[model samples]
Target: MNKHLIVVTAALLMAALAACPACLAQTAPKRSAPEERQEQKDARAARITERIELVIARFDNNKERHVAAYNAAKARLKEAITELAEKGYDVTRLTADLQAWDGMFVKFAQDYATLINLLRTAEQYAPYESQGQFAAAIQQARAQLVTVRQDALDIRHYYQTVIRPDLQALKDQNPSSSPASSGT
Candidate 1:
């Protein structure tokens, strides 16, 4: 009888321990700090880059529709910068930097458009030597466009890594100062 009672007591104690919240909590795996943060930053940057690239690709793929779309997207980006400036973000400095970048991108796009137009013209005219020249021009424009695209990507990456983190830290430091948080 004494042995049976001891056995039952041990079983009950084990059962109680299994039911504890602390045991459940301790069973879950811990997350690494840096890994989690890097994942979050990568995801955010990917989203922004994807949106910008999609618009650019849409413009590239559909020549007939692209002019309107490209203009609209550019206008929207400009408006966004203006809005950010109005909200007390450093518009002047950022705009100056972006304008320089924009000029490069515009030149690339113009060259690409000219190349495409040349190709179309060559195809319609079907002159042998002109075809070769048009082909060479198209290839050159494509290479330039690739470089411009890479530059834009680099700028975006910099914005994500340097600009965004600083802005986020500022927002965190002064929660009430942010327009979004202030409800103003």
Candidate 2:
């Protein structure tokens, strides 16, 4: 009888422990639908904030590379133009086109810098409470990026349409030795 009573007590204790979680769940305050929605919204905003920060970091890193590439290309073109001029080829049009391209490059760099600044501003306002400001900054940055894209395209178009053709014409005009070499 003693053994049976001990076994029954242990079983009752185990059952009570198993049911306590359900009892506590019923007593706990339930999250309303609105609260759940707000939580989801906050989680989404946090994810967007993280993405914006990542984009800003990447843009910052790419800025230096863009500047380096532009300088290298500009220098190469200038050197080529000087060499051609020394070889008695007329590079007047090439020189003008180069100047125009340089102006476009300057605008591109400026616009890119503006976009970076806007991105930084957006990062500053990425909190859910300041979503409106963050969105505005993102829009401004997007517009600036469009301007930068157009500037880059204009540079490429000018180089391909005007500069390259002029360069090819100069090469064709002086297929033989340089004037000095020809005189030798």
Candidate 3:
């Protein structure tokens, strides 16, 4: 009977020990100090660099698209002018349309440069984690860069959906559905 009781107690103790880790695991997780090391920061930066490169490549790939859109807009503008001339609409009225997006193309180009510079800066600063303040700054800049890129996409979408249709409408129902006017 004594041996049986001892065996039962040992079994129960072994089960309890096995269950303790599961119970503890239900709470906060343990993180080793290495997770907070410079290597981790560098790895994160590398991943961000890869993402940035892919995004840049995609953006470049869309260059033809962007130029095509611009060309279409210009062609429509010319058509609108020709229609107005035929209809005897004053030439100066077209100035409103021309000035609508004035300076925006240059601004957009500058914005791309700014984003590229910001990404390069982040890549450079990413591994320099010795200074906590600098590391925090790098993180903040990266976050802001994400916002900037998102804002750029939003602007592009707005142009495609809202502005392009309006320009096409100004062409007096002349649909912009051909790649013949692609090169700008």
Candidate 4:
């Protein structure tokens, strides 16, 4: 009986040791250095481009919905600006943000454009390949859209908490310089 117990314990220990590497491997984070860099670049670009587009949309149509959207987008823009600033990028030049943002914007826009085209083409021919592509594109687009919306919220908060107060202070300091001061 003593010998049997010893043998069973040794076998169990061996089994656990053999499984350790696989367990460790499964739990480990898999992001490679290049992948991490690319993800950062992509996120940064997405932030800037989405904000700019939202801003443009606001100005293009001054509806209440657009105004709200603009505010939200501005909040995201400010967050991205803060992030880039922290990342040691001089955001003073719109060119830097523009370049990054433009690339991401074009990528996402083209993806959506392709999805639309696929949808139209699928309707005409009913091919499985086109249908599958369209469905996948739509799923990816929806996920991306959620990220874009969250970024917009961050921009709106930044505008409200930081930009608005500064502007208000400037106005207060220069109250007498405005024609509205006459109460006409």
lDDT by residue for model 3 (1-184), tens: 9999999999999999999989989886767788667568778778867876786677666644765675677567667666555554444435444454434544555665665665556555544554664455456656755665665565566567755665455456433333222111
Q: Report the CA-based lDDT of candidate 1 relative to the real structure.
A: 0.55
As a TM-score, model 2 comes out at 0.70
- Candidate 2: segments with Cα more than 4 A from true spot: 1-19, 22-42, 60-65, 172-184
Residue range with the least summed lDDT across 10 consecutive positions in model 1: 175-184
Tens digit per residue, CA lDDT, model 2, 45-139: 77887887798788767767777877898888888778776677666777777788788888888888888888778877745567488778888
User: What's the lDDT for all of these models?
Assistant: 0.55, 0.78, 0.60, 0.51
Best by TM-score: 2
Off by over 4 Å in 1: 1-77, 121-184
User: What TM-scores do the predictions have?
Assistant: 0.36, 0.70, 0.48, 0.28
How many Å off is the CA of 91 in candidate 3?
Answer: 3.0
In model 3, the Cα lDDT at residue 61 comes to 62
Which candidate, 3 or 4, would have the higher TM-score against the true structure? 3
Predict model 2's lDDT versus the native. 0.78
Candidate 3 ranges with C-alpha deviation above 4 Å: 1-41, 62-64, 127-184
